[model samples]
Target: MTPSDASPWNSPGTVRQLGKMLFDHNPTLKINPSVIPSIVGWGLRFLANSTYERHKANMISNIRIARLSLEALRSIRQTAHLNYDQTTRGTMRVFPRGGRMTEFVQMCREMKQWGVQFEVLDQNQILEKEPCLGAVIDRYVGAVFFPDDESGDAHKFTNEIARLATELGVQLLLNTNILKIVNGSSSRISHLSTSRGDVSADVYVLSLGSYSPILARPLGISLPIIPVKGYSVTVALNGWKGGPTRPVMDDGYHAMMVPMGDRLRMGGRAEFAGYDTRVDEEEGWRVLDDIMKILPVLRSHIDANAVLNWSGLRAMTPGGPPLVGPTSYANLLLNTGHGPLGWTMACGSAKLISDLITHRQV
Candidate 1:
């Protein structure tokens, strides 16, 4: 969300059998004892229902939503007059191993069919886009550049939106904790039982990130969402001119380094620790190490002791796309379960939910 919050808007492993195929890539993934049975049960259901056709359909839906959301973000930035270290140089995904480029090429071709604009760049082209990466250019075979993609301080954008909404006569409720959702007699949300008091709304939108399922369960809605924890570390450039100018996704380590204004934010690692938002300093350092492995020039410029470590939970669903739109309860709509792409797809998802609520054709 911001440098302060662990949410990436600004911005998983199995047993031995599942590990190599799925989990091994994420060494940080760990399941809480309470969620083990649930995880296993959901895993079985996922495997059983998963099909190549189904996966393709989901991917297509997610990609469309993401592309639309990018445009929405641009509009919001203009509306809010936001310029919090916003980078429009586009984003890049570097494939350290040459073999990975082949798979990416195939994916790019398929994406191109959907009108997604991307350029497949060799090592030299990648360096040209971000000269700070020259130190590790040899380590990369090629990269896929998404020209439409952008990066910025999600926290600042969120706050600006909130401020704008308030100016539009929207009431701002702060420090009020929602204890539960009170159901009405006729398949709808009657009101919310909050820590402050009981508040009623004609319609309610359940956009409570990872905690959405907790309240929905009492209402007989079986939300297949899990809280996946992720880690991030932000380091000041400290006059280091060699840091990346834009966002870079490292394929080898499954991480991202985003230049947020003068600060460089590097975050990655999916740990299924379930609601534990504890920051592991060592893990943060490990992320730095992973980044340094690719950009060795930053080694001398960064001070390890000054890095800020943060952790946040993501609401992930079995299917990649978020569970948006109306639920069984007519007045209660869903806008959660976005996982790691919450910030990227926020505006599009919000627009979709609003259109649905207003009975507008989407």
Candidate 2:
């Protein structure tokens, strides 16, 4: 069925937990709320039968989030006139009417309290919005897209955010890993000794991403942060026939094509090979082939083609959603594990983390 009629519980991640619940509680009947997700989901769904509406609301919100994020980047870049962009966070118009293969696994996505529709954009309508994508618009039967999907420069964005945080008197620390945790109990963390030095505060945050667990365990807390390694290739946008545009991701293989300034960020594959953050050809070019396959006009030699290619690690949790709640420790809160949406979720996540630390509810 179309996303319009699809249920949020239709997602595999929630269903897997559901299946586990069905088995864990009893093979025959039902169990308890322990296996279920948030209470709001169960109560609103089971009691009132409002899940479908909620799912549609959430899908629309995703579109708005994608849109707002793209606008933020575009506004920032435009204001600065800096030449930088990325596919992971930006205005990405997926046009099936232009022969572009658009597919992505939306299997385990959570429906937000807000609205964001997952309805496929019509092929004809998308091209009208993005004329430059006319060539690759015809291939897809339908599109599950974030129209405002833009390519983001995380390094640039982080640098900017750090500047803002500094302005807000939020101490910005980088490469300063917390080597040890001193205390945790009654929702309070006492001290954090980083590689640089010991830091004692009324509140401490763990934005350590994938390395969160190593430190969390010592404090009698378990953080479900897993390193999800992904590979990205940056190809130059100069001398390319096709007009540079926003980012694209192949739903079939997690392959993404994102245009940033004068370069294209092609990403593909997610390897669960422990903590190794090495970049190799086989893993890096999984999406490259797809790029050449889809957008042939931009094809060229590896040397002349790409200015830089690299891989980055994303901290993923068991469920795709980020871990953004306070721990048992009042001072220690979790803010990592954003996966692909880290850049998009950064501002919101940081605000939420900030709220948690300050005891703000909304």
Q: Any runs in candidate 1 off by more than 4 Å, and if so which?
A: 1-18, 21-28, 32-34, 48-50, 360-362
Q: Which pairs clash in the backbone of model 1?
A: 1-7, 1-155, 8-11, 10-154, 13-23
Compared with the true structure, all predictions reach lDDT values of 0.75, 0.54
TM-score of 2: 0.69
Candidate 2 lDDT tens digits, 1-362:
01121232223234434454346421211333443342234233322322445444434533343345445555555655443344432233343343323323242134222233344566665555445456666654555554333446677666775675577797766778778988845556678888899888776777778788888887788766666567777876655536445555444333566666656777655555456677777545555766666665565434543446677767855434567777776567788776556776665566567666677521
Clash total of candidate 1: 5
Q: List runs of model 2 lying over 4 Å from the truth.
A: 1-10, 13-114, 117-138, 168-170, 184-187, 239-241, 301-307, 360-362
- Give, for candidate 2, the lowest lDDT window spanning 10 residues: 1-10
Leading candidate by lDDT: 1
Backbone clashes, each candidate: 5, 40
TM-score of each: 0.90, 0.69
Provide the lDDT at 176 for model 1: 92
